[model samples]
Target: MLSRAARPALRAGASLQTRAVLPSSANFATLREIEGRLKSIKNIEKITNTMKIVASTKLNRAQRAMQDSRVYGKTSNGVFESAETKPVEAENKKKLVVVCSSDKGLCGGIHSGLSRYIRREALENPNFDLVILGEKAKSQLQRTNAKDIVLSFAGVGKDIPTFADAQAIADQIVLLPNEYSHIEIVYNKFINATSYEPAVVEAFSEEAIAASANFSAFEVDEELLSNLREYALANSLYWALTEGHACEISARRNAMDNASKNAGEMINKYQILFNRTRQAVITGELVEIITGATASEDM
Candidate 1:
């Protein structure tokens, strides 16, 4: 121990040990961070997967309801289609736009697309009022078109819409003091599981229905025209609500599926990174031990 060469060897080993300890501690910290991230990603993956499954289960039911409502709505409006009804061209009259959306999110652009359509329409013809159903669209339109929003409804889309719900909403609309020339029901139309688009279902007012090009062909009593208008509006609203619900379910399923896949990918990458970092740290420790042993042996 007193020898000059032995002293130098000890000093060299001490230096090497110091270097190794510092780097090992830093690497351990890095490894801990990576491990924590991996755990968080794994948890995220589980949640996304569960959501995807739930959406998939609900999709079938929503689509069935949509199909049934579509038929009901079309049958109710068949008379108007046959008569070729058209809204009267009155500049003094204001039109009503009913926007169908849901309170919940995670469906890609379903609500936003409807909002954008309304905004674009506002830019072109600013003579319309909004009757928004659901919180999502209401919140969006309220920011820019607060004055235009005459009515907003909540607690919708919690489940499949019943005809009673639509009827109740129609009754409220009919009671409004501001008479509308015509009402347009805007909703996300379900094209397929992977696709949907904004579409409109027209609900003619009593005046518009009466002014049909072939109104005289039907032996309809003039007294029953108001009741027909109300019934037609309810049918159309129910159809829009069901179709929009189906689209939202499908969109949510796709979105959650994609999220789960992305989370899985991240998890895999992080796991590999963690393994590599752990191996590197262990290797560094082993190398330090070996180097110190060799230096002492030389002494």
Candidate 2:
């Protein structure tokens, strides 16, 4: 019942339809891949945005704590400055170095910078012991100077550091079996919202403070010397901890902000690619249909 010419046209149309279907299936697969990537990027953006908000919220409180602690610490150390107190270095006397860092990471190279400074100091003098406050620094130091670490504290920098926290840490240092001639606290000095530097705050021993050339200038009871030293150490620790916390929060906020921006850029790129690919697929289908229709008319 079918003419020969009609059969040929029918077969040609079926062939063209098959070819179109194959490419369309391939295009769909590619579209699916792109969609998956886009979804993943969106999720990453959400996570980074959330982290940025948290860091921003904590930054204000941390900055306030840092300011208050700075004032308190400066006031406490004024006597030492007036007397020009300096630690007496001796080969037999061991030095204690306390590193102030946080347990949480993702805040740029804050903890790493502190760790590097300690490593440099170790190279200069291996006789000093380490007391790390925070897991990040402790882990880094333990890899190389495990034996030199006398104490390590966790759960620090979760919130603004309090005077009580510093007092407890100072009490532990004072109770150590070995007597240290000098106590140095290493912390991130908050220069601005975007800049910070690792610095040291020295806490001299009772003998060192009294040995200063200008010690006679300050009239003080010998009985109060130990109490004064303990108080000064606590005040310095609190200042260091608060300042370091502020720096960490600022760094984290910046890092998360950058991450979110990158994710948004990736999403935009993928969206464009997806749209272009879909348009190309539609154009290909139209071309196939037009070709098939023209062939049928010729038949």
Candidate 3:
């Protein structure tokens, strides 16, 4: 028989059991929430998959174009490389830093790598002026103390970069007087559809203004070279954007996967507690029935 004090305790225990089960509803809620999240993720997956396919397709073509053009860039370098005098003709020495990065965010290290390049170069040497491409690089470089920056461009929105853009940039840098004439482009060259390396800001040419302004001479017989340079830079730019998207997709996928696993564990834990609560109630009812029968028989 349950004493008066014990009865109160038993009632309290039952109340506690009900309270424990309260959170069990969260299991269903979790299932529902996951379903919604899964739907959204599915949509995002479709978008990412589509982008991946497009980037890879373009990457293949761009890679081939860049490879073909590299031979010409080598030839051009060979002609100028042998020059005995320093080609950067500026009476005063100045460096032009070209910043390349994605306009969009979510790509893992694409922007981060570019920023590091600027910090190491610009912050390391306050002598050079920066030329920023893409919104990320431009926004980041503003925080630096570099001086005499002549040209800064932003908003090269999507892939499929054109020669016009590169030409515009090349033209601007070449126009800088001899003092600020030497130029380097900081960009992530696309290695594969999935991966891109750090920003490479290689000096394109140190040719004085005469050679710098010769677009016609550079492209006269080397149509293929021009095409290659165009795509190579594009490939570098395009690759960074694509790889960034891939990184973001992978991160989100991993996070969602973990959420699903945790939900499953929680559901299992609650089920165990619920089962134990039910068993305890059954045992208590059995004890009361048996004790009441004994009391009546004794009377």
Candidate 4:
């Protein structure tokens, strides 16, 4: 009952209706394929989200512990640095390097940062002795073909770190001959919840330790100074473990953030493809019908 002019409008209405209800069968398959991909991305996003939350929680605790440990470490460093203003005793001495890395994996840049820390020290100091704490660090050292390495620790955290763990490492370093004039620590310093940097290579020289024994600094005698020295050494060991833990959580959080973002992007891309493909399918059907009707009219 539609007029000739209205027929074109009717066809347009039909085309729009068809586009809304039924897409091209060819593109239906493509849409389903994209739908499957979207589902995968959704699952990936959920997993990444869970990991990010866990990392966030763990990082908070780690940061608290690191903060608590830093107070003692700062006191040690300040006293030591100030003491350096005094006269020197031992010069041109051997260097001892303590490396702090992780037992578990999945943290971005942490292992690599620690590895390079070792490489830089080994390459720079010929007389340096390495005391690697984690398996990751040990493996990295072997890869660098740095054979002159010592495994100071096996399982740092079978569960979590304790003062005993630090004590064990300190024992090894302390047992080394005093001819190795200085002790240096290489670790990743956690700056914030999402940022970290390769900790400045910190070395404690005998002179610094001696300077810390200044009568002006602490009203203590040689015996007390010796005891305080032992105490400070233990504090240093504990500080490294806490700082390393904090850095690990920060790195894992960052890695998970990237993963979650990538998943969301994939889902968006697939949805766009599905929409465009469905539209193309509707336009194709419309053109086909219009061409057939024009041919019939001409005949």
Model 4 lDDT per residue over 61-144, tens place: 787788888886787777766664332335565566778886778778788887876677666766666777888888788777
lDDT of each: 0.91, 0.91, 0.53, 0.71
What is the per-residue lDDT of model 2 for residues 30-91, given as tens digits with 9 covering 90 to 100?
98999899999999999999999999999999999899999878987787888989888787
Give candidate 2's TM-score. 0.89
Candidate 1 vs 3: which has more TM-score:
1
- Local distance difference test, candidate 1: 0.91
After superposing candidate 1, which stretches have Cα over 4 Å from the reference?
1-13
- Better model by lDDT: candidate 2 vs candidate 4: 2
| Between candidates 1 and 4, the TM-score winner | 1
Model 3 weakest 10-residue run by lDDT: 201-210
Per-residue error (Å), model 1, residue 45: 1.5
Which pairs of residues collide in candidate 2?
Answer: none
- Per-model C-alpha RMSD: 2.4, 2.9, 8.5, 8.2
lDDT of 1 at 261: 94
